[model samples]
Target: MPSGGESMLESDNGTLGWLNFFHKGIGYFAYTMHRISGIVILLYLYLHFFVLSNLLRGGVAFNDLITSFTYGPYDIFIVMDILLSLVIFYHGANGVRLMLNEAGYGLKHHKLMFFILESGAMILMLLFLYYAWQVLLSGGGV
Candidate 1:
């Protein structure tokens, strides 16, 4: 039978193999981030849809639902809300860029493409930070 140390090493080997697969090249980085952003946006959409569904139940129900989501945990909500927006925007914009490329209209200059992608990501991040700051300053508890 394998020793305890041998089994542990085997498990770790498997884990490292998975990590190595993801670290292969720049393509993996883009694919990983794209997937993560998709998940985040999906979660946000669920939350937003749930909130809007309350509207169908009447104004009072919607108000109560909003209050429950935003009050008491104002700081946490603000942070999540800001992040949700950024995730959605980045995922959407990146998806469009990727689609264009797939359709044979991609950027010929690799450096310029990456630069624009990074710039767009940074702009979105800054916008979220700015909103978070606004909330904090206004005593929204963010």
Candidate 2:
């Protein structure tokens, strides 16, 4: 009989490991990205609420927070904002694709659908970044 450690190792070997999960195929990649994007958006929601709660301290506090975002050193926040927007766009678009697949539309062409979804997401992100860059150069906040 195999030892306990040997049995455990066997099971682990048969399972999809972390590196394998990423390298399997486009479906796995899309699934992983969807999960990661969901988690990021959830975390961003908490941060958004925390920032909004500053209003409880009155207009000055809120304005200070807003002002910090508009200045020189805080320009990084604009970049983060754009990244968050891209994540949101990707998650939302992929979600719609998933819904369509669930409804039995394009089930046979899952790989192709994933490619289209990813391409669309990239295009949208690029357009968004372009607009955001224009705004930033014109001295605007995200």
Candidate 2 vs. true structure, TM-score:
0.74
Per-residue CA lDDT of model 2 for 1-142, tens digit only, reads: 1111112123242444422444456665566567678999999999999999999999997877776775655757877887898889888877877777767776677677767877898898889889867875686544
lDDT against the true structure, each candidate: 0.58, 0.69
Alpha-carbon deviation at 23 in model 2, angstroms? 1.9
**lDDT by residue for model 1 (29-141), tens:** 44445567887777778978977888899988776666665664444676677767677666666666566555655445433554577678768788778876676567545
Candidate 1: where is the Cα deviation over 4 Å?
Answer: 1-22, 128-142
Model 2: ten consecutive residues of lowest lDDT:
1-10
lDDT of 1 at 20: 42
Q: How close to the true structure is residue 37 of candidate 2, measured as C-alpha lDDT?
A: 88
